[model samples]
Target: MFFLKIRSIGCAILLSICGQSAWAFHKDVYEPRVPNEILAQEQQVKSPHPVTPERIEAGRRVYFGVGFCVTCHSKDGTGVNLPGHPPRDFTDAKWQKLRTDGELMWVLKNGSPGTGMPIRVGTDITEEDGWNVIQFIRTFGGK
Candidate 1:
């Protein structure tokens, strides 16, 4: 009876692994896009700071410093680790092409669901800083 229970547990674990593998391989049907309201907000909401070289530099500082983005996204923004699906590679041409600055801002303001990224909106990150970080991310891989 004990052996049978062990076998059952092993089977359950195998099924769980298989399920997660299937999900990882499964292609997403829904394409991610920023809503019009969010896009409009980017334009309507004036940043206290301008997108100057200094602002970009400041944004870079935040990305590596207080923001702690490098912990996952990596110093180069090329992503790190591959065991459990690596973080998004900001260097990807296709990804850069598909995503907009507003979309990036939206992700910053509201963390990506099911991701390790924490909600940074009301946190230490301010709206202007968020926009600045977006500007910094834009320069990733020379995009």
Candidate 2:
């Protein structure tokens, strides 16, 4: 009976921690990942590359290939739920509208804080590839 009580308490504590963390992730879905100091400038920044079918296709390749974006964002861009925080749901129209290509690039270059996203551009992909991937991500918004 004592052991059962201890186990129950442990389980309850674990559940509370997990629940709070999940809530935290969902609560900040629309919050800017970029730091406030540079967010405005970043938002104003535009992709040098034009949006063409070819570039979008190339971006798709980067997302699924070297960028390894598919691992977290998933095939459908709905994102996969990981342990600490759920990945961004690219299918979210509001989120797509809220984020800019340059801001996305910033996240790619500098991984999002308090999340699983790692520095991707300089590490695995190039700056151009990052821009291309942003174009590809915009497709998820159906834009």
Candidate 3:
């Protein structure tokens, strides 16, 4: 009886470890990608450029061109299947509502942790292009 109990406990431990590793591969979609230290301040930041048709068009050009966002996110913004963690689904209304432009900009400037995302604003695109692309992203959610 004691041996059976020990075996059960061992199995539980193994399951727990496996579960944690699986969870580590994909981050919670709703969880803020921003670090907690500056999340509040970052959330408050706003885009200097207002949403406009011209700006959205410009953003589209960047997304399809220099941004290289299409390679991973796909043309429809549904995101492609990736190895570690799947890219975010921009079409999700809930996710669109929860995220702010500032937070998106932060992600552009600083690659999201624990995922495949990499920095793009400073390296590939200008800050203005980042904000414009954010506006274009919002369109996927019909916002």
Instruction: Give the residue spans of candidate 1 off by over 4 A.
Output: 1-30, 33-50, 82-85
Give TM per candidate: 0.66, 0.80, 0.82
Candidate 3 residues lying further than 4 Å off, grouped into runs, are 1-23
Best by the TM-score measure:
3
The positional error of residue 117 in candidate 1, measured at the CA in angstroms, is 2.5
Tens-digit per-residue lDDT, 18-87, candidate 2: 7667666575889898899999999998989889999999999999999999999999999988877788
Q: Write the per-residue lDDT of candidate 3 for residues 34-98, one digit (tens) a residue.
A: 99999999999999998899999999999999999999999999999987678899999999999
The local distance difference test score of each candidate is: 0.70, 0.88, 0.90
Worst 10 residues of 1 by lDDT: 27-36
Candidate 3 lDDT at 61 equals 95
Which candidate would rank higher by TM-score, 2 or 3? 3
Highest lDDT: which candidate?
Answer: 3
Better of 1 and 3 by lDDT: 3
Name the candidate, 1 or 2, with the larger lDDT value. Answer: 2
Q: Find the 10 residues in a row with the least total lDDT in model 3.
A: 18-27
Model 2 pairs whose backbones collide: none
Ranking by lDDT: 3, 2, 1
